[model samples]
Target: MKEQYMITHEPPNPVDYNNLRLEGGMSGKSREASEEGLKNSLFVVCVYDEETFIGMGRVIGDGGTFFQVVDIVVKPGYQGQGLGKLIMEHIMNFLEKHTYPDSYVSLIADGSADKLYKQFGFSYTYPKSRGMYRKY
Candidate 1:
């Protein structure tokens, strides 16, 4: 039996954003931070099971030259259910339509999730340019 989930460009509310991340084993962010940050989303796809928020993926960048795929999360109970791929499909569609030839799309795949991104034509940058981030 296939479950029905709604995928929408409308992002979750601040509470949902913070809760769903924690539910999916990702780190938590303050509701205040989420409220402010979400307003700046370049593109976002939020997944819902009935009215319950379950998963989401967001693209954030300066609108050109660079795009970072962030917050790709599916609730623990919903893992391995193809929700991540669905989120990526929408994210890719946004990129395809908006990106220029020189645009760079980047992500940090935690654990084995890199396999999923690879299917979408993402290549790792190694032996050349490496990634650096300042996580507080």
Candidate 2:
């Protein structure tokens, strides 16, 4: 049989994005915010099972000086099937083409997911620098 998965370089619609975030055990975003945020993304990778959006990852930032890997999520049913890494592969390709030596790339890994990020050369920035955030 042919493969059932399709990877596309496109962002999910706002509603799908919010629903997938919740399905993936992450916080949901408002439609307006999701729309605007996605519109500004430098690159996006979306995975679909046939036609249903199941996983996605994105790179967002000023496009030159800084970049952040975010919204890396796969549905609970789709986790552990290599979908996350597949998504990262696409994001890494985009970064490899666009980022420069001075560009800073970062992501805030959650729980055991840090291990996955480490596979992509991400390391903890503690002791020397810590991550702090104020969510509105």
Candidate 3:
């Protein structure tokens, strides 16, 4: 049977965000941090199976000259069903409509996930510039 899912331009609640991140093998952020991050998102897309949150993705930054794709995750059981692509499609749509030509958009792909981002025009930033981050 084909499962039905709902996609919305709404941010998931903190609990759902943390749960999905952990379930997807990403680090879980504190509830307060998750709340604050979602509150500051430039755009968010969430995928749900009925009332259950299954996947989500968000874009955050100044919304003008800089943007970063963050927290792209899908629940373990739902990982290979094209939900990730659906989420990225929405993220790209949002970027296309909201960003200017000079805007800089970026994402730090983990493991094999780089291939997914590549499908949406995200390229490696190695030789010219490297991706750097500081963890406290």
Q: Please report the TM-score between candidate 1 and the true structure.
A: 0.95
- Candidate 2 per-residue lDDT, tens place, 1-136, comes to 1267998987889999999999998998999999999999999999999888889999999999999999999988878988888889899999999999999999999989998999999999998999999998
Q: Give the C-alpha lDDT of model 2.
A: 0.92
Task: Report clash pairs, candidate 1.
Answer: none
Q: What are the runs in model 3 whose C-alpha is more than 4 Å off? A: 1-3
Q: How many backbone clashes does every candidate have? A: 0, 0, 0
lDDT of 1 by residue, 8-79 (tens): 998789999999988888899988889988999999999889988889999999999999999999989888
Candidate 1 Cα outliers beyond 4 Å, as residue runs: 1-3
- Displacement of residue 15 (Cα, Å) in model 1 is 1.0
Model 2: residue 54 alpha-carbon error in angstroms: 0.7
State model 3's lDDT. 0.91
Q: By the TM-score metric, which is better: model 1 or model 3?
A: 3
| TM-score (all chains, Cα) for each model | 0.95, 0.96, 0.96
